[model samples]
Target: MDNVISVILGGGRGTRLYPLTKERSKPAVPLAGKYRIIDIPISNCLNSYLNKIYVLTQFNSASLHRHITRAYKFDNFSKGFIEILAANQTIESMDWYQGTADAVRQNLRFFNQPNIDLVLILSGDQLYRMNYQEIIKEHIRTGAEVTVSAIPAERTQAEHLGILKVDEQGRIIDFSEKPKDEKIIDAFSVSPSVFDRHGIKAGDRTLLASMGIYIFNLDVLNTILKETRKSDFGKEIIPDIIKKRRVCAYFFDGYWEDIGTIKSFYEANLKLGSPSPSFDLYDEKAPIYTNPLFLPGSLINSCKISHSIISDGCFINDAEIQNCVIGIRSIIGKNTRIQNSIIMGADYYESASHIRANRFKKIPNIGIGDNSCIEGAIIDKNVHIGENVTIKNANNIEQLDAENYMIRDHIVIVPKGSVIPSNTAI
Candidate 1:
């Protein structure tokens, strides 16, 4: 609705995804090689015919902000755009947003429309695709003050999520934020017939965990924020209002992944190449959009590729690749092999004599000698491996330089734009 506004919570330290997020915010982390994480929600909004978006974040948001500006350029003359609402300490009582509620509270000034009916709040780092219109329909039908989109989770996983107890009418009767052991012991496994595939269980004690998506009537949202007087929906806001307010649950079931961890992120990327992935970005219904690179079609140069989502303008020559995502304009040397890894993560390309994996630990020295062999690693942009360099786990250091790179949990991270010395070991 033109009278509605969307707020995306993008603020988080994202310390868990250290090296990847070192120079960028979580939302800014590149997804699908070309699109950033924030594009998922923005694309959802655009496809669902929702406009007016505000992204909230604090740490290293420069890249995220730049991408948002460059990617989201709808018809400004009408009423479609994506905006980043960063943390600002304009008020004497102001500080950085401490929690979710606090983040939205800090940007209340953006909600200036008297006609605005609902505020759609979402998380920026999740990997999924959905139509928000359906959730909005449920929200209006229930006449709820706050409607949360929830999905079924494993009982053990539910312990770490903000769970909901919804009545037959789909109205949330109880809400608990990341409940403890005994509190969720009696959790029910809702019957398949209890609710449709949205993973909604309209059963007794069948706790549904919130997916961090909320739809609130603007007035009710303003009122709740006023009443709570504290930041964060889980810690202060929602938990405090459920007793005195009508907060409902909207169940959603399709596919979603919060790729906030390096392992999860890597796993999610590999899943994209699976025979049947949990999340599919190529869906025509809700296609994900990002800043257009306008690159040409990707070309595989007689290379053997088992399973990889190679984007535009890629060249492969007698190389072996499996379970990897190759971005645009990336080149693989003849006879080089890549397996179970992400490569050329950024959109860059330049003709190099030889480049291969397993050099992530070593300096990214190009000019690899003819007989060099490499494997099992991540390669940063524009690295040159000298000719005849061998990189493998069997080598004596099993780890490499700290000045240009560092190994975290066995994942080699090459700092951006560092050249590896030839025959580097130890």
Candidate 2:
């Protein structure tokens, strides 16, 4: 459990996220106001007391690197360190990583270190709180070459994941990458028990979906890297090698989400505004770690809040905020109304204005004018909304200034420092 080296894959192009991925890697995408995508995995490693970590990233890794340096600075006593292994090709291989396995094969220095027994492979794009200690113990006890962290998902949902099939002894008997064959009874289900508990028919019991998290022995990782000819581990390397190796499955029933697309990112953030979110960050046993900052709790200025997460340095005036996350130093003006939205960083709402938007994290600092109304929009950093602006309507999709601004979920994203004119409608 203690002698483990975690390697997080952070090399996704995030094509579905488009503009959001335009500036940074998928793992660097801004999450829940104050956190980034890579924070989840790093926090897990920190909380689990696993010190040595290597993040494999190449696509837009600048922001990701900066964040890691600031967020994860190891202490002298802990000696645990988080390092970013960005892609750097030379004469031997002058190309970016083609797949997950290729990323690790390029950075073989991780396994070269001493005193590392287990290699923990994880996805940097997921949001969840987990303890790797349990999975490590299972891997060690099983004496298997590889141990995969799996979950029960539905047949339809398994299409988005690497579905698996294991025998009674928990040995991985089959592995398919989003196979569409219905006759395949050994397919993985997203939540078999959930459907069974909810009275839904047992669509597929062999539907063991892989969470892309694996625990491997240091020698096993090195051997796999040497034997593997492909770039990706899941789609190519792992599945190909499983034929001659001992592969087992470790079931994970905790809250896990993959923020790989715009829709998924939006939905995942909205989940935080739920009455009782499935993902709990306040757990004492395994706390999510973040860089400390000095700030007071949120201040509601005679406002009415209905299910929202307000961080420190927020001042909500006599307004109504429902299902929105107000970040630090955000000042909601008097008589303002925000609903089912995300307010991140520093936001300023003037008096008598109302807004309803998803992914409000675009703007690091934004100010809405008085008597204005915005809907279903993604306002970028340092944006200014004039009076009487109509961003979203019944259509729920707006295509404006996309050449200048990035688009996520069809929301009109005003770029940083953008100022909207009066009587404007995006």
Candidate 3:
């Protein structure tokens, strides 16, 4: 682990998660109540005792940079540090990151340093906790040129993921990216023995799907990038390199979700309030780390909150919250009913005089106002929901672009710093 360097890919534009990604990168998007999506992988790396990490981002990286800089600060004596490598127009290449492999290629100078044996590549937007030391251990034991963390996927999930066929020795022989045809997908399936070895049911028709978590021998990574012109790993590089290199599959059976879309983003946040969440953030032994805001406990006054997670410094007064995740510094006014939603709370709290001034000027201060009904929505930071506003989207719109908000998958997304006037209906 000491000889390994971790690179988290956060350079995607994240168009699928539009309004959320409108102001920040995908990795910077808020998760649960207080944590960001990048926090998951970074925390996992820290828990594995791998501290030298580089987060690569090209689009809307300001907030991500601030959060990382504030949250992770190593002691002066230690060499451990988390650095941000934003896309730059160097003389060698003036283009932005073309793809995953190209992004690594452009930043080769930083990673091609001393005493680095393995380069562990991970996605920043995934929601899962993995002990990367296990993958590195297997990579060392097997003497593999490249090792990919894979998971057992059913047919429904296999179509969208990178499916691979492995032999008895756990070496990947063939790979396909998002094959829609059933016959082609079946051909890329692994044997039942593979599932049995991973403790999965033998009768299940599951194929080994790449989780996009890879460990590359430093020398091998340098060689592949120098020889090939492929842009992406899953789409082009891995499929071509499996024939020339010893590419092994590391099976991982755990909770993993790629919340890159609006629907998935919404569901993943809402699922956190469930009785038993798939991803556990409350694990004390391997807890997720984030920016420590020293705010007071949430104050609830005559509110009925059920199966919800309310973060710090919330002022809830006579509100009914159900199956929601209320973020830090949230303020819910009286007679508000919110369900199946995620309120990303405020970045900063307004003073008493500021609130009075805003009220006098007829400006909605922050958070939900009184007599509001919000369901199936994602209210980003600094949103001011006015009184008597109905944001139910009763039409069940699959998609729409309203003046105040956007609707995707029947979920209204109020982008950051939006203001909805009073008595508005949607």
Winning candidate number (TM-score): 3
Candidates sorted on lDDT, descending: 3, 1, 2
Task: Pick out the ten consecutive residues of candidate 3 with the lowest summed lDDT.
Answer: 197-206
Instruction: Please give the CA lDDT of all the candidate structures.
Output: 0.72, 0.70, 0.91
lDDT of 1 by residue, 9-63 (tens): 9958888776677778988877766678888888889888998888898999998
Model 2 lDDT tens row, 74-115: 678975778888888767578888888888777877567777
Cα shift from native, residue 386, model 2 (Å): 3.0
The candidate 2 region of ten consecutive residues with least summed lDDT is: 356-365
TM-score-wise, the better of 2 and 3 is 3
Say which prediction, candidate 1 or candidate 3, comes out ahead on TM-score.
Answer: 3
TM-score of each: 0.86, 0.86, 0.98
lDDT of 3 by residue, 248-272 (tens): 9998888889899898888988888
The count of residue-pair clashes in candidate 1 stands at 15
Give candidate 2 misplaced runs (Cα > 4 Å).
185-206, 346-365, 398-418
